[model samples]
Target: MAKGVISAADQAEQLKQDGNTYFKKNRLGAAIDAYTEAITLCPNIPVYWTNRALCHLKRNDWTRVEEDCLKAVQLDNKSVKGHYMLGLALLQKEKYAEGIKELQRALDLGRGAHPNSYMVEEIWQELATAKYQEWERDSTKRSWELRRLKESCETALEEKYSRDDVSQKTDDTDEISNSTSEQLAALKLVFDKAAEADTPTDVPDYLCCKITLDIFRDPVITPSGLTYERAVILDHLEKVGKFDPITRETLFASQLIPNLAIKEAVEAFLEKHGWAYKMD
Candidate 1:
């Protein structure tokens, strides 16, 4: 209560931490604002400049990032992070010679200070490989560079989602597979029932159509109060005459309604004696 005013160093440090928090949350604009405020409060902090450069890098503002990273290096020539970010920015802008120089410098510093840093990631290895591959063919080198671009994108995605709870990922693959299997089983059952109705046995006279003299694939009724297979009845109406073959009564093919009950009985019979269908 007595000392309400914050010290400049403490305030700047707090702002820098706020920027880090915002950056972690992917609020790049807010993070940049916080880092800029921190830099204004404490211009000598090279890390603050480097942190702001990282936010700009996220936005793909390579020019702005290059400027910030260059300033960070000017303040602290030994800043490995500053050189790394500057190298990435220049590389993104296709300034390969300058970018490679800065990256090699960062790699050299990283080897001395921290051997297991971002410089050891696949991106660096791929670039190094691509630089050498360039001697063989320009197209092959471009392909490697394209892979590097994709590698950077994947790295950014990893950074964003690395903290997410992977355990909560709802996998519906089993459910979909089971559902498809069940549907196919149901379809097979229907086909089996239809085929079983054709079993070898003395079928009931009513179940057999007079035209084909066999069980119906699709049974239909006529205006003359007789049922027959649809194809047989239609053939008789079109080829023979528009009259019932057995009853000799005038009938129309358009009068056919599905004999669903008969069809079900036939299907049940065929299901029981599928061998009879082979005999037919």
Candidate 2:
């Protein structure tokens, strides 16, 4: 090796460092240029592509973000940043199915690598949002189909008896009407039962404390970012162990923070569904 010549890998490392500096300063264009040069020098390095994709994401350049993240994931399939950025880009383009798929992958990988990390929480939140949106859209479609079916049934019934005999049709009409009502009542019972099964009768999982498996009266957050009832957690801290039960991570009484958001959520839920209070 020549004394004055720098290796391509070394040069790429230097460029990557420069890109990090530029990104920290919010100089996205310069950061992207540096990352691009690093990527050119070491195309197999997933970090460079992922870094550049982040810059594109900030600029709302969904197409470019998608391209860079795809390249990054191809280089390393387990790249969390690659899948996360690609999911965000696909979501921006309203590709819900593909976006949710990528986000789910990112969540799985991030959770495995860093169970209590903020990145894993972010992935979970995004995946949950995507799933909810997809469910809502599908629900709307199902509602429309049900309405159409009802309309079609009414139209068919009206057409069937439109030209029946005036005298004899009266008895026949009454019998058919009774039979149709019975059939419709049976169908309604089936639908009502299905709806009851689908509707949640218990407290939401978020509102319940993991330790007590009951709705939180006073929620507090731990350093691990999990919420639990204040009294239960304090009791656990005193008697059980100095660790988060769910994450098995070291915890201290001083590290507990008031989870005001969750507290407010529980209050609102109880206000809307007062019967939940008796759901023992």
Best candidate (score: TM-score): 2
TM-score of each: 0.46, 0.69
lDDT digits (tens) for residues 132-185 of candidate 2: 566556555666766677667656655554544354566687776666667667
Model 1 C-alpha lDDT per residue in residues 1-280, reported as the tens digit of each score: 2588888788999999999999999999999999999999999999999999989989999999999999999999989888888988887776776876887777777757764355544334534533433223444454466556655654554453433324334465455445545655665565456433332357677778877787655688877667887766777889999888888888886788888888888767644543232223
* Clash counts for the predictions, in order: 7, 0
Residue pairs in candidate 1 whose N, alpha carbon or C atoms collide under 3 angstroms: 196-270, 196-271, 197-270, 197-271, 198-270, 199-276, 200-276
Q: What is the lDDT of residue 112 in candidate 2?
A: 77
Candidate 2 is scored at a TM of 0.69
- At residue 86, candidate 2 shows an lDDT of 97
| Per-model lDDT | 0.72, 0.81
